[model samples]
Target: MQGKLYAIGTGPGASDLITVRAARLLDKLDVLYAPAGRKGGRSLALSIVQEYLGEAVQIKERHFPMTADATQKQQAWDAVAADIEQDVKQGKQVGFITLGDSMLFSTWVFLLERLSDKIDIDVIPGITSFSAIASQAQFPLCMEKQSLAVMSCTADADALRAALNSHECVVLMKVYGRFTQIRQLLEELDLLDHAILMANASMGSEICYPDLRLIESGEDLPYFSTILVNRTWALN
Candidate 1:
């Protein structure tokens, strides 16, 4: 019997946000794996579904280095992939859960690239934080023929400024530590009034602020935060 590897999307935070299909698949998982940070070896996704998983099911936390060092990051991902591969090769079904849509900017991307060729991979799509944020903020992304750009703000300030200047419905993912700089750019472009910042979207820990300046003056937002800019001028 060939085991399966499900790339499950937990959809932000709320357990209900998980897709019906994803939830069903999760219920059947023999083993659950999630990315763990350096300090606390707890998986956010695992915690969300902890109540649902059976006591007999095995849970694995693959510690992923939360740093900018490229070498360390690759090593960590590779190690996780190897661990997942070991389980799947033994004909044991496993679930690799992520915060948002697995195919999106989620860490599941790394797992997919590493394990797809070795096993049967099924990606269960779930509501992305950006989509949830937009909905919560009552901001429709685009109408007709309007494009949306999804990119990470983990790059330099210049790169982020370029993206903000170029894209209209830009969903800046991973704005964890760069909120200050991003807020400054938004204010300079007079977008502070219209922009919406949704932190920890879909999760039980969620916060939204309409004023970019207000968010700028506040504390650092979680990594799950996304910046939604409805460039009304771009629609013109």
Candidate 2:
């Protein structure tokens, strides 16, 4: 009997936010794989679901390098995929956990490409950080014919500007590193007052800046930080 691979999303940060559907699968997993960004690093995804995980489930933390080199990153994921493939082929119910939604800007997407054709797979979607942010702030993402755009801030300056100009609401992911540049673009478009900087959405340490101007223009934010730009709503 070939075992199946479960691709699960654990939601943003809070454990209670995890879907009941995803929570039910935790106890049935024989092996749970969690991703670490560097060697000896902790897995945030694992931590989020640790309380609900069954004690009998074997924990496997694999290092998924955070880098720009596509070849290097692929090699690492290839090794991880091989491990998962072997486990599933061995008839062990394997689970790979991802933070937030499984499909959005997730490493799980890359793994799916490699293992989808080889074995049985089940996907369980979880709430995204941006979705949590909107709910927590009581800020509607879009309404009354307003358009919404979700994009990574890692893109070049021109592309960033386009997203701001085009969308009624924009959820800027991975904004910590590009904080200054993103802020400048918002300022250029006169949307600085409409933007909110939030870090660790739904977590205990969550910080929100309803007024983006209060944040230092040159200061980088936490790694989990995101910027919500709502042009139609008065954020400040």
Which portions of model 2 miss their true places by more than 4 Å? 37-41, 218-220
- Regions of model 1 farther than 4 Å from truth: 216-218, 233-236
Per-candidate TM-score against the hidden true structure: 0.89, 0.95
- Per-residue lDDT over 104-175 for candidate 1, one digit per residue giving the tens place of the 0 to 100 score: 777788778888788888888988888889878788786787767777887777776777677667788878
Superposed Cα deviation of residue 177, candidate 2 (Å): 2.1
TM-score, prediction 2? 0.95
lDDT of 2 by residue, 1-236 (tens): 67999999999999899999888898788999998644465777888888878889999888777789999999999999999999999999999999999999887999999999998999999999999999988877988888998989878777878888899999999987778777778888999878888899998999988887788866757889988889888865
- Which residue pairs of candidate 1 clash? 13-203
For model 2, what is the error of residue 219's alpha carbon versus the real structure, in angstroms, after optimal superposition? 3.4
Per candidate, the number of residue pairs that clash is 1, 0
